[model samples]
Target: MIELNPLVELIIMNFAVGLIVTISLNIEVGYLRIPQFGRLLAVIVGAVIAAAVPGRILALYLGLPYGAEYADHMYNAKIVIQINNFLSKNLLLSLAVFILTLVLAALAGGVIGYLCAYPALRLKGSYLGITLLTFGEIVTSIAWNYQPLVGGTAGVYMVNPFAFVGSGSSSLAALITLTIAISIYIYAEILARSPFVRMLKAIRDSEVASEVYGKNIVKARAQTLVIGGAIAAVAGALWATYTGRMNVASYTRLTWTFWPWAFMMLGGVGNNLGILVGVLLFTLARTAIIQYKYVITSVIPIAAEWLEYILVGLVIIFVVMFKPQGLMPEKPTLTLPRKAIEEIRKRVEQEQGRL
Candidate 1:
């Protein structure tokens, strides 16, 4: 059997993560028309939870103290070692803990998202975007400076849930991440086909019109935010667990916010199929650049680190200039039943004849 290269595995892992982040953004910006510029907020919340929650749970499960004692690096390291040793001997317990962490992380994210909706109710467009962006920056700064949050700049090491898989842990993680990504894509596709999606599009197109038709625009937006935020948080949690570390620095605006937005735009904002294509294209290009930075720099006479940004900017510019709607523009959704649509069409023709 041919063994998979670690670099290939890492690329696949990143692509899966990108898919999750972009799809969540699609729900907020594409379907609901909520320009959530601070998409990092929900993602960081997940990472923070992953950093703190699972360790505390493990401490309690192992009959250890869960508070300040666990916060100490020395003490925490000892406990982590013990837990690893125990998990190494018991695969079932390790898997259970991993699954439980994901569930708790998702719930925590949902709660934060629900609270965020209150502010969203009063804000719109750029104002809403700026407000959320500021909030994300503030929280990230706190996480960075505050030692209690993921050990500040130093960060905290996390136990690998798939350690039970031994030497194949990286491959297992890649497989799991891809599975979850596919599941999220399917769910988003289903949402796109639903009447609720039509309602979202209606609200996106014109809040006044939706409200005039008796739709609660604020409520709808809140609900959409809650759902999208929860999903984004899950992506963050997965990243934290997969990497076996939690650090505020890892959840930067560039990684959690800007890139996902870029993917959404390049892929054609609301189109799921476009999202997949866009993610693959951008991710492959990014990985290739990173892998061949020396050759690129020698050829281009520019810093390799800056080239990725330049490429992203160029793609965005070209897409906007030539295909403003995206490579695959948003298509009109048919929500009403076929018979109902036919009846409405016939009525419209009769009214036109009388006119």
Candidate 2:
């Protein structure tokens, strides 16, 4: 068996995570035309749940600390080590625990998105976006201060359910993540072709007209956010699992929200395959810049740490100026096949002639 290159693995892993989140964003912003500026909220909530929940459950199962003591970094590290040891020997239990963790995280994220629907129904445009952004910031602050929720600023270690794979654990984890991402991409494609999405598009293109046609505009938007949040949370859970740690500070708006938006815009809004392409290209660029920042900075006399941000800003400008429709623009969708529509039209005309 050929070993995967570490650099390639890193890019693939990041691209997978990016694809998951970007697709979620595309569903909201591109398909539903929702101003979901708080995309990071679901991700952070999911990561926190993934980081804190499963370990506590395992601790309870093993007669260990699952409460306040478990939140302490010292206790967290020790307990997680014990959990990993146990998981390394029990493949069935490990798999069960991993699935449970993701389910719980997705639920938490979905709940948050559902709650945001209240505000979403009332606000529109930039106001809604700002409100969403504020919600994310508030959650970050709470997570940072609430020690019981993943050890506050110190963060908490996660139980590695893939520990049973031993030396190939990380590789297996990356493969699993990528697999999930691809599965989500398939789901998104199916959703895009569904009648529900067509309804959403009608509302997106014109809320008043959609309402005039008996569509519940508010309900569709709410549904979009809930679905988007759940999907984004899956990405966050995967990240937490891959890193085996959850730091509240790590989930920033710029990283989780804005970057995904950029990816969606660059790829072509509402285009799922385009999201894959955009995510792969951008993830490669980001990883390469991070890897060779020192070399670039040495030659250019710029701050290495700021290079990625500079690249994002430049890319956004370029996309807006020259490629507003993106690399793969959104294609028109039809409710019926042309042949079916023609048949219906002929039937209607024949009925009219008989009348």
Task: Give TM-scores for every candidate, taking all chains together and pairing residue i with residue i.
Answer: 0.91, 0.93
- TM for candidate 1 is 0.91
The lDDT of model 1 is: 0.84
lDDT by residue (1-355, candidate 2, tens digit) is: 2346778778878999999999999999988777889999999988988988899989999999999899898788999999899999999999999899889988888898899899988988999999999999999999999998789989999889999978778778888899999999999999999999989988888889989999987788778888999999989999989987888888999999999988988899899988889998899889888899889988999877688898888888999999987889999895688899999999999999999
Query: Per-residue CA lDDT of candidate 1, range 137-237, in tens?
Result: 99899988887656777777776777765677768878788899999999999999988888999998888999999998878887888888888988988
Separately for all candidates shown, the number of backbone clashes (residues 3 or more apart, or on different chains) is 0, 0
In terms of lDDT, the poorest run of 10 residues in model 2 is 1-10
Worst 10 residues of 1 by lDDT: 68-77
Runs of candidate 2 exceeding 4 Å displacement: 1-3, 340-355
Q: After superposing candidate 1, which stretches have Cα over 4 Å from the reference? A: 1-3, 335-355
